[model samples]
Target: MIVRAVVEGRAVDADARFALEARYGHFTAMQVRDRRTRGLAHHLDRLAAANLEVFGAALDRAAVLGSIRAVLGDDLRDAGVRVYVVEHDGRPRVVATAAPPTEVSARPQRVTAVAYQRYLPHIKKAAGFAQAHIRRAAGPLGFDEALLTTGDGLISEGAITNVGCLSGGRLLWPDAPMLHGTAMRLLEDLDVPQERRPLRVADLPGFDLVFLCNSHGVVAVGEVDGVPLRQDAETLARLLAFYDALPWDPLD
Candidate 1:
């Protein structure tokens, strides 16, 4: 069972965490093995590079919890699954079970195989080269992180989290080829300014601030190399407060 619990305010407990695997209704074990073998390494590499510490393979909460119940029966509480829960505004918001944080370099803009094809030989090869080039480009630029995308002007999300930018005091995200993440939808409902349009790299310099948002947490603008992002304390506080008040329902 995949347990979907609210992570209230960055609270993480190491003893209650567990991992999960999804059960597809019809696929045979052999089929599953075949699929898993195909792109497993690439997927794992991406997840690892993104600094995702805790991860589970459940499709949803019910599945996660059910698996726990099956394994431990009434003794589930003592299972030591290392669940990480965060709550905001007295409500649970994010949950995960995984390792502690990992370091992410700040430097050349993160590029992706999807985005680098125009400049590289093949998309598959481009994906492999993205990290190396980003590392090289960002080092001289004095930045610690670079984000990659599909180059179709679709800034979907970041290698690690969803992207949020401030343009004329309006919050915006790329419109196409990106997942409408739960947090992204919530922010939109709060009437935080949103722009569902193509996002260009050249446009980054025009934004007041740039941030990465996700179910796990939100990090404020610190530094994009030498670029000083506009940090509006009041705006951030209000936005966070708004998030804190939202229902845990991802669909809402």
Candidate 2:
């Protein structure tokens, strides 16, 4: 099923454009089971924080969850749930949608680096034109995703998902401003050893095990800029098992 929003009163056309001065607002995606989601608090907090930054007001978590449940119902299991807190006519509004669950396999992917960085590093907003531009340009050449890097030759993250290098059982992240993924937060809370430091494009070929992670799960990188990576099957397995065991919280 696709994410169908339960639109109410006035019945504005779905194609209605954003108000003249409306800016890109916050959004979040989660996997729903039995009308519940994982990392629920973190997702909500993401919306709250972004709402404050973009709309200059606090997000109504309870009302937002209610809007989500209105669309999800009480028995939706294994669905792709999305929450959008957008600015309409200069005011913030909550909109939720749901679709059939889609999972990116743990299969290794081949990625290449691109020189770019996101506009809002801290807020998970609906601005992804740069990412889409890079992905479109790279996808045709048989690459899974584009790794965004800074002009100073520092690696940041991939087009959409976050990337990390595994070294001696510790996850090494780039020491730059970027979106802190909910998945990474969960992994850190799991006591997984991690460190943040500057990563250069020149070091991409030397990483023993580099993987991509987002809300779906973790997957290894088979190749980087035509260089084959040494896959770590054990680490991937452990991540999948641990992520699958995370508890789910109800929308209420």
Candidate 3:
């Protein structure tokens, strides 16, 4: 549940509601624990870069941080936070929202490949109808998530996660276009043998294990397109450990 919502360092008002309703902006979501978040700098940098692209202006990082801090305040230390830069009254505005914290799912997830791609896959848009639609449609099909792919069968990413295939003791990420999520960036910094290769739906059987990562948490994939994947608990645990070892940056 949402504990608080703020826009430009103040509670939601008419202008803030308009900005959110605009639906032509970008945002970043992260898990905040003890008033700190992991990969905070990367999250800020992502906002800046996306702001430049979406609004043709520089983002006020300090103001964005202020709104997030304002929403969290002293009473709320652990929560899920999202910082959005939206256009309102012909100017870009910052909106921050906080909710209960989230963690990686303990059970493995099942996903099916879908032949669909987003328009600007690099930037995480505020309202992605295609992704949301696919996610909702997945449940009725008896899948936990939808793995998006191109018409040519090239794997790109999940509806809300980045995918990695563990083959021969190495992690292989798809080379296709997709959002570079914060958790995936942190994972890339680890001292592991990982590479980017052109993966496809037909190549799922060759991998020994498959996992998904996002700002929320890391999770293992048990099946893809009805192809059963390896559920190597040791590998999944080791990957999560490497991610958790990263120091969390304070929200101050």
Best by TM-score: 3
Q: Write the per-residue lDDT of candidate 1 for residues 137-199, one digit (tens) a residue.
A: 665655544545565544555543457777666887775454333355557776755677777
Residue 170 accuracy (lDDT) in model 3: 89
Off by over 4 Å in 1: 1-61, 68-145, 150-154, 247-252
Query: Root-mean-square deviation of each candidate, in angstroms?
Result: 14.0, 2.8, 1.7
- Model 3, 155-199: lDDT tens digits are 999999999988777889999999999989998986769999999
lDDT of each: 0.41, 0.75, 0.87
Score every model by TM-score. 0.47, 0.89, 0.95
Q: What's the CA RMSD of model 3 in angstroms?
A: 1.7
- Model 2 has a clash total of 0
- lDDT, residue 73, candidate 3: 87
Q: Give candidate 3 regions above 4 Å deviation.
A: 13-22
Residue 19 CA displacement from its true place in model 3, Å: 5.4
Please list the residue runs of candidate 2 whose C-alpha ends up more than 4 Å from where it truly belongs after superposition.
7-23
Candidate 2, lDDT over the whole model: 0.75
Q: Residue by residue across 55-168, what tens digits does model 2's lDDT show? A: 899888878777677767656666887677776655676766667987877668989888888887877776566678899999899899878898766888888888888777
Residue 31 alpha-carbon offset, candidate 2, angstroms: 1.7
How far is 77's C-alpha from truth in model 2 (Å)? 2.7
